[model samples]
Target: MSTAWQDLTGRARLRDAAIEAFAAQGFEESLRSIAARAQVTAGLVRHHFGSKDALRAECDATVLERYRQLKEESLQADPHQLFTHLPASAQGGVLLLYILRSAREGSAAGRKFTEQLIDEALILLNQSVSRGLIVPSRDEPARARLLILQSLGALVLHFALNPPQDPEDFAAVMQDYYSRVALPTLEIYSEGLFTDSAYLNEYLLATAADVPPATDAGITESR
Candidate 1:
């Protein structure tokens, strides 16, 4: 459990329990089960949040905010620390699993939750550019959205293919998954696949009518 879940009272305790329960068992997890996890009554849960839907929305907000905080902290640390912890923390963290469940459940709130994530990514990437940690993009919004999509899309596919026996095993499963991908991902980022940007330049020229030609450093980031 996260230290964030510790030393809680009333509504806060219920919220943390709901995050854990929903992450483990999906959104269909009963209020009674969540209440039991928090050592509270279901009626108390209803009293605080009114409905399961409201509780879920609250969980979504909490998860997103937690992610934002973690990422901001990583930005202030060694940039590579983020990727080093990505497999376990970002992939296996309860907050992330909860968001993934939201996306898989296909609820309206679920879709909105994902859109919110992308928006958050946009803000973070803009910060990165402003700090000169990363090069500015010709189309900043597109690049931000693409990075989030590629990352979360790959994670969604990973879980679908290798469904864990228990949610508690999320960290182990994701760590193993990242072990397989980490080297190649690092290599691709460190070493360009193509010898030159001829193909990209040609494509840019072809599409110049729609937008002005501008070269971006792809994924340039300061160490």
Candidate 2:
């Protein structure tokens, strides 16, 4: 532990330790082990967090809030800085491991965490759109939700099969993951998937929807 680590209150110490323990070992990791990691007693863990499940919930909230802070800072400074800064953050690997485990575990808390991620992503995506950094969507909320789900779902699958041997290796693994996917992802985002508007036109006609057909750029409304 560093000087800063030594200065934390017992509850903060226990929570930080629990986040590391759960990220490394999974939620089944015991309170005694977490206390040992924190260099605090098991009784102190109970005093602070009440139960293992409660502590896990705290970890979930903390990780999400920290991620939100990082993203907001990156966006406010420069959106492009996210790629350069996020992987280098002190808690980067641990945070990634914690979120990956939470999402893969499929518990009620995990599901809620994913939904909360989508909500945050929606807010941030809209902010980017307003800043002219991202394209506006016809249905903004749905677009944000879909993009969040797609990206996270792909990450979950990729890391589940090819997880880092240790939590500290997460940044490297993420770099490799992004290196492999970046070209294809950027291509699709920039060039688009469809060759033309034939599919959209056909679908609109077939469905006879109130919404007008899409043009070369995107969906357009009837004047």
Candidate 3:
């Protein structure tokens, strides 16, 4: 292969390896192990990625890419039906791993990556607000951050308690909680948050696809 082809192939392999490693072992895994999995030398991994932090960032980006792609596909498919297939536990597990790893390390790379993750999450929440899928209230940004943190906390708690035997279980609980608790609370915060019934329907559909519904029927007594 040409030099350009070689570089592209190497980079692709490195990215794939990094995603697998990060998903499995998180940021604490050794660089050597990641490089080995990629069938590349550590020097090569460093050459392409610059540093361990850079590599971790790249891995985080890859994971986010998966999320973005899923969201886009779901929106395109039947925005209302898109979330039905979501894997709640796996998604939660991966995100939890990233957050915990970053907090534990407190490295510049970890902090930067965590901030980027938070920013992206806020952007998504804001997008939902703009679309009227969510209620718009004071401190929109803060609300978005709080929601993301809550979701993250739920995943962390689930992992600590369950350790995820079946990923679907995680998704089911997440979906149920969001529908009964999260979505209704947001709606109450601002009825104007949703543009129409379609938006609310889509939100429920997508969330249900992503996680399981609550046990007490679709309507929770509190909401």
The TM-score leader among the candidates is 1
The C-alpha lDDT values of all candidates are 0.78, 0.76, 0.61
Cα RMSD (Å) between model 3 and the true structure? 11.4
My TM-score estimates for the predictions, one after another, are 0.83, 0.79, 0.62
Please tell me which model should have the higher TM-score, number 1 or number 2: 1
Go through the candidates in order and give the clash count of each. 0, 0, 8
Runs of candidate 3 exceeding 4 Å displacement: 75-84, 88-100, 103-107, 164-223
| Ranked by lDDT, top first | 1, 2, 3
Model 1 per-residue lDDT tens digits across residues 33-65: 999999988998998899999998888898899
- In candidate 2, what are the lDDT values of residues 78-145, reduced to their tens digit? 54776677555557667767777777889898889888888888888878877877776656678777
Between candidates 2 and 3, the one scoring higher on TM-score is: 2
Off by over 4 Å in 1: 1-8, 79-92, 215-223
**Candidate 2: clashing pairs of residues:** none
RMSD to true structure for each model, in Å:
5.1, 4.4, 11.4
CA lDDT for candidate 3: 0.61
lDDT of 3 at 11: 85
